[model samples]
Target: MSMSYIDKNYIYAVSRIRYAELRLLDGSVFDRLIEAKDVAECITILAEKGFGGEYRDPEGMLGYEKSRLWELIAELVPDMSVFDVFRLQNDYSNLKAAIKESALDLDIPGIYSQEAVADPMLIKQAVRERRYKELPLEMADIAELCHELFLRTGDGQLCDIMIDRAAMEAILRAAEASKEPVLIEYSRLTVGASDIKIAVRAMLTGKDDEFLRRALAPCPLLDTELLIRAALSGMDELCAYLMNTDFKDAVTELRKSLAAFEKYCDDLIIERLGTQKWNSFGLGPIAAYILARETEIRSVRILLTAKQNGFSAESIRERMRRTYV
Candidate 1:
């Protein structure tokens, strides 16, 4: 497609998103939130910022804000499937929840996420009935495999690993098929970072090479085989291997703790996507807005949780993600 055509197509959505981006919370807002004396104070800050309005509890507030975010996206974007790469993870999560709930014969409420490309209820029904035809081909196949694996082996971890790897693969495939640079870059970074986290955790827990191989998805930035080998060796070897990759900067955070490493990954994504703010037209800005809002909500959640748990302001600050504004 021509650049002009793509730009024209996304003009309205981008324009709307530009206005929406103005409401996004900045670093100072997050700082105030972190410094809040209590959860009530944190909620007051969020309310002033027009987030989680009238929802006193954190869970309800966050959930309402998330639904509002997607609702806005659905209103602005004509073709929702273009952003399926972002929502497919939620679909897979619901699939995982449904499969486990059905297998264990338990009624787990609020376990499914609302931001899915597919209907969570449909996924739950399909898994319950063993009706794979109801789901998308990619999800259907994995759902069947994971359902049977969970049933036969009773190993939730294995099932989770399978579904998680499949979710990453699906994301990569969607990014490629969309032919959008922003989506492609996001997918590459997301998968690469996930693989790194998996390697780090596996090495710490002494998981074998086979588990690492199975867990890590293929991304352009990182060599999966080398990562597997490095993970099998040790954290130092893995860190050394990572030093030669795009994630070298994250090595220091990785050495700190998993939470710090995750914060580093989120910050990297925000830094990369921040460039989209200058683009006058195209899906990039809209996508960036969506991610920015999500990041803001997550930072708020961290603050509220920390305040509720009586965590120190410095500790909460260390865990806060970078803002996109």
Candidate 2:
């Protein structure tokens, strides 16, 4: 096969990812996990599948699996910054955790996610010590602003909203700066879906238009102005507005339930990323592989939790996301 520069660059990485994809948990694996009599049985099945070796605790096993995913990706991609769009949310999440922990003087364990490019502990230290210069420029400013907002108003929700909006904007900026079509599309879909979710929640809670406007981030795929207005009007108006946009198909899922809508959004992204399997070039395949693995891990976690709780198989299946394999 004739290979272009992009193809040649990612040839080895894609080949390795092909092998990695084979081990991804599919629907059958989830079925078994769901049917497992107890958490121990579920852990055994996961161990047999090489998910998290010897970690009996479900949370421990899941955490191990997440860390392993990032470790593998780090080994494959030399310049990890290429995937910053995926990791930026974790950074913001850590910032949120740190800011709240500092304000409340609470040592909240397991609140920080390890799937970020920046060290979570460093971010926590920077926030705790008010050392803004120690963090990245964008993050430093956001941390300071969120800290001040939380301190002044004692409104955790407002602080969270500000951080979430900033995170989405950062993801959008990273996607645009990369100039990768797949990354840009992924970012747009993520941000647009997030905006929709925020609007829906705000509408349901009877939040004012000003709150919605502040919470929703700008995205190329959806008109933010129209979205805020629709949200202010009600669910019907919001659905009607969505029908006219690129997210027309999501209307059905939105009607079903919020969980259903979330699944639909994730499935849409997975379907788009699945196309990268046939392409032999660039960062798309790598990005797809990472996302697919993350999705599979999430599905496994859900099944494990449901099984541990003795939930019905049908109920677990309903919440299961689309498998990439």
Candidate 3:
């Protein structure tokens, strides 16, 4: 929220981030995690490395790590609002959870995110009390609509897609408002990736145009109309259209599976943000650090879940994302 947000050189922040980058989970730590005999050993390894904060269980430990991440970022930055691109999704996610919770009148454990701009508990209250004004402006109307839609029709999928599309649009607005290259690129990539996933999924499932149009959020990088047509026409057409955009590479992964394509999308962002390590000024490095840490957390979650499910190391490795380090 400064007059010129990135005018001040973040020398100390960049240096500290560089130092912290060394501690990011790398291949070796991941190897130990993958090879761990059980979840207990994995927890012990993560705890020894300064994770699992105050609890040994995965959910509590991961929640602690997430809270600690935001706390650390708040201490390092002048205005945390510049990082709304990362936090806004949590708000939308909470909105989704709150809508469902209110409609069902049930409290689902571990359903909401921690440390979002809006309190998750407050969102639940607003929806339950029918006080839309209590929610953030971006979410107020959508919360009302989604809550009613779910209540009236009991169509969870429909409500979910509506909220998902809204969340992507919210991310785009926040990214542009920040006027940061890293945020903007991440936002566009998110929309582009998500829209393609919708189209590909729709195509395979033989979804109609109305459903596709409703599900696809607008993006400057991809033509929503053309993508919709391609998806409706056939998978071949969808793959051909994808080949022309920057997301052409994603087509190959889409052929392999949705999970593979998701990993590709993630690695693509990390590849771009990877260059930010050399940046010593402005918000890019700090933003990249946030992203790197989030990716680390996500990767850990994936690996540990796979281990608990008895997945082979090779299968887990294929799903693991590229680290920032």
The 10-residue segment of model 2 with minimum total lDDT is 1-10
Cα lDDT of model 1 by residue, 1-325, tens digit: 6555644458878888888888888888888888889998888888898888678789989988998988999898767887898888898899999999999999889999878988899999999999999898898888999999999999999899889999999999998998878888888999999989988888888999889888888899999999999888888998999999999999999999988999999999889999999997778888888888888888888888889899999999998899998
What's each prediction's TM-score?
A: 0.96, 0.95, 0.94
The per-prediction tally of clashing pairs is 0, 0, 0
Residue 127 local lDDT, model 1: 95
TM-score, candidate 2, is 0.95
* Cand. 3 TM to true fold: 0.94
lDDT per residue for candidate 3 within 1-325, as digits (tens), equals 6566654677777888888888788878988988888889999999988886769899888888888888888878877888888888888888888888888888899888876888888998999999999888989888889999999999988888889899899889999998999999999998999999988888888889999888899998899999999988987898899899989988989889989999999999999999998998878999999998999999989978988898888899899899888
Q: What is the lDDT for 244 in model 3?
A: 91
Best by TM-score: 1
Q: What is the lDDT of candidate 3?
A: 0.88
**Stretches > 4 Å off in candidate 1:** 1-7
| Candidates sorted on TM-score, descending | 1, 2, 3
lDDT scores in order: 0.89, 0.88, 0.88
Model 1, position 90, has a per-residue lDDT of 91
Return the lDDT, model 1, position 159: 90
What stretches of model 2 exceed 4 Å from their correct place?
A: 1-8
